[model samples]
Target: MPMVDTGDVRLHVQRMGPRDGHPAVGTVLLVHGLLTDSLASYYFTVAPAFAAAGLDVVMYDLRGHGRSGRPPTGYTLDDAVDDLAALLDRLAVTGPVHLVGNSYGGTVAFGYAARHPERAASVSLIESEPATAAWAAKLDGILRRVQRELAYNETDALAWITVNRGHNTARLARGAARLARETTLVRDIPASSVLTEDGMRAVGCPVLGLYGGDSDLAALVPWLEASLPDCRTVVVPGHEHSVLVEAAGTVGGHVLALIEGSGGRGPGRVSIPGGGGGRASGAAGPAVR
Candidate 1:
């Protein structure tokens, strides 16, 4: 584990290279979701697989999460994107790299791709969407509810989560509560400037979106495909927002397919079946659910 000072925030980063002293095929940056999520998600799930596939893997804890430096302010989406850029500069990863992001991290990855399209080889979003006014409103509602239930009613909330979601989830929720109560994360994220449809369409890199068939976000697949120029989406059946962890193999396989497909030429709509034991359908073709 190494900590890199990005001038503004110190990010905790982890890197995994191809095994057997082989040269990496390319680089893949993994970004985890907000609160209760860190590089550990990818470390425990897809990071090793990506590395084993001969790709350089980079994972980092976002500011105010995991082992990263948590400032009281500056938790906007823009701030997170800046942190990614600064981290890449510090690590000297100059070439175009595949970007894989989960949840809020997906939003950050999309923003980075939008801002630096030349450096983005491709983007894979798992259960995520681009930042928009609707996204902001959704986040505002979720954060407010978290503040009310978890922060304001801490003991009861933790107790309920422990009973329902298990002790580990309760522990994570505790940290999330502290983050919401102590920092400006809840406020800044909702207030972050959103991207217009034009802005999203401007990103020329190949984009891949993976969504859980049962997840509400699956509905956004059509919009994403329609919005991005060279975008493809997969809907993994019988899962929800936690599909990244629940079906790591499926997610990683789709991402790797996108990375490999985008290597020489532009990626077209292709359906790759049976990578991590789960079946996936292309959202562009038919509705999975």
Candidate 2:
């Protein structure tokens, strides 16, 4: 429940690993997807692997998304990017960082790294799409559904979520539903980010794009992996938008590979454990999808 004042806003953030770890090599920042918080959405899986691999982990709720302050306005992705820069500045942990982002979080990471190329040591993106023309209509469709669910105090919305996302716990489903209707500060942030694709070409660091082989968004993998000069991607089979949890080991391997590649420590070979792989050309070579 630690809150840091990022000058413009107070952000709710959490950390893992030893306090004594050096910021340069051990710090990682985990950015959660659209409607969830740092703890509930990201910490359960991604953070631990980094911590176990001798790195410190940091995560914060985007404004209005989790335990962070729900501002009356300012939910744009640029706002989120500013929030991230503000937090990093506040912590003073200035080093090329290892960034892991999921869904909209991935776009946020992409935006930040593109805007501030010097701050990234490496990056990992899961179930994420580059800011492209393909995203506008897709976002409209998601927002329309989200708005429709909110029109009735979220009863129908909750039901729709339950039927569609039945794999999540009841508490998580309800919590997400409640956040949808009650939190307004972070709404439209993801949709707004879809309006730009110029930023997509700005990324120049080692990056891994993650998606479920079965997910609808998986189709965008080729465009992104090939476009970025130093980027590649992996797709987990039999999973969808929820690739992080559905395929933790495979996802974990990719995260590890990205970190290793960033540090110039490739393992000589990467094994998928139980999923398929995609090939891309870059300094790091092809990795497990």
lDDT of each: 0.83, 0.67
User: In candidate 1, what are the lDDT values of residues 1-289, reduced to their tens digit?
Assistant: 5999999989999999998899999999999887777788888778887888899999999999888998999999999999999999999999998999998999999999998999999999999999999999999987776677775678876655344221266667787777888999989999998999889987898898889888888888878878899988888887788887777777777787788884323323322222244435555544643
Superposing every Cα of model 2 onto the true structure, what RMSD results? 4.7
Q: State residue 241's C-alpha deviation in candidate 1, in Å.
A: 0.5
Give the number of the best model, judged by lDDT. 1
Q: RMSDs, each prediction?
A: 3.9, 4.7
Q: Which ten residues in a row have the lowest lDDT in candidate 1?
A: 266-275
Model 1 residue pairs with clashes: none
**Model 1, total clashes:** 0
Which pairs clash inside model 2?
Answer: 26-56, 97-121, 234-289, 235-289
> Candidate 2 versus the native: TM-score?
0.81
What's the residue-level lDDT of 235 in candidate 2? 62
- State the lDDT of candidate 2 residue by residue for 158-254, as single tens digits: 6666545424445555666656666553255545554344565667778887777777777766667667777776665667777676566567666
